[model samples]
Target: MKYIVCFSGGHSSALCAIECVRKVGKENVVLLNHNISEEVEDKDIKRFKQEIADYLGIKITYANMEGWEYKTPLRVCKELGGFKFGNGPALCTYNLKTKPFYKWLRDNFPIEKGSIRDDVRIIYGFDKNEPSRIQRRIGVMINQGYKCEFPLAFWDRTITCTEEIGIARPNTYKLFKHANCKGCLKSGKQQWYLTYCLYPELWEEAKQVENEIGYSIIKGSFLEELEPKFARMKCKGIVPTEKIKPQTFWAMVRKEIPDKSENLPCECAL
Candidate 1:
């Protein structure tokens, strides 16, 4: 039985790839990444794919979901009259990532006629910190007749701090965090602010998408309406001397309150 590590080129999947390689050896493991033209840049995507392959010294396969057109959440919102504030970006996750991922799995490893063994596990990199996301991914894999393992689920600051203070940092954490598309609709305002300052081209692309779709994704207001307010706003708040790490930010947030169990599976989990 082959052990496949589905690589989304995200932080979670990157960590999964590393753990899978260490446990099963590189020869028996495969890293799988999908390419969708519209959602992410071709150059950035290729770099991510190559980086993983080089880091693990393993052969990685690139899969293109046939006729997979890149459709942003904004487009879906325009067609469906927009989801509630938190729910708007969820549609993009289902359509762009999850659906294509499952489709690829079925095509390559068919279930009918019992072609593949049921025990072959799929490794996902959902961290222990994200209970809701971890549960959703596990539930989906179980329904698909595959066991799911999460190696980085319980990884904490000790491991991260040790790595950072040491000679090297994990490829998963460094590359994947910055690898998210510059204008990811799912990102919060802080992320969007950084994107606006750092990568204007991608920000413009997002704006164009919103305009073409005739819908706003920011919720409660459109970018066209918000731009003026943003322009007029003064930078009164102190800028941090060092940028806060994503993991640190999540850790701090998690400490402020108990993690809530999601009553319903995220629509993206589908």
Candidate 2:
């Protein structure tokens, strides 16, 4: 049996990798990463991933869409002339990350014919503080007949644990609450603004995508129109989210949250 941690080059996922490596032995643990090329090209996220791997001393592997000519979400949005957004995860979440990751899992770790053994365990990084998210994630994977677990939930480790481990967390965490794509479709005014100054090339692509779609990625203003409003503004460190009360198991089963595995255009695309 193999245990896979869906490493996202972020705090929670790194902690999960470390603890799981300690528990199951590094040979039994693999940090399975699925990435959007834009994340590496624009945000330079690969360096963070390398740091995590070196620090954790665990074997980390990646599953990426090498066959897809359009390697980035911005390109996909431009090709489609827009994307649908709602309460669900972003379109790229499936098209770029989860779908490929799932396909890799199925191909390499084929389900044995009529075998009942649970040969795989996938660990997601949702922290103990995010009980509702943890429950929702587990519920979705369970519904999909996956053997999933949340090590951070059990370990009760958060971002603080990353510091305790003597590794600096991903820079995206300092800029935003979550480590997502450089020009994520879900980004609001603030993130776009930061991208505009920090990564003009990616931001320009996003602007072009907005123009092609004839819709703002956010609610109202176009990226160009909104750029000046936040020009020269300092990056807001990890926006604080309002507390959603943790729910019971039954409540999670009953909750109508959208797909949890690809719930956000997050670092893990989960």
Q: Where's the lowest-lDDT run of ten residues in candidate 1?
A: 233-242
Off by over 4 Å in 1: 36-48, 66-91, 113-117, 154-178, 233-270
Per-residue CA lDDT of model 2 for 39-69, tens digit only, reads: 4333446677777788767656878876443
Cα lDDT for residue 161, candidate 1 = 25
| lDDT (10s digit) by residue, model 1, range 1-270 | 566887866645766777677677888787876655555544645566667678779877766544455544445444554433443436655665676777877877767652434646677766778799878877767777666777777533223222232323333233235445445666654465555555666667667767866666566555555443333221222221115665674454345322452222333335
lDDT of 1 at 57: 93
Candidate 1: global Cα-lDDT? 0.57
Q: What's the C-alpha lDDT at position 149 in model 2?
A: 78
Supply the global lDDT for candidate 2: 0.66
Off by over 4 Å in 2: 38-44, 67-70, 85-88, 112-117, 156-160, 231-270
Per-residue lDDT, model 1, residue 172, is 28
- The per-residue C-alpha lDDT of model 1 at residue 181 equals 48
**TM-scores, in order shown?**
0.67, 0.74
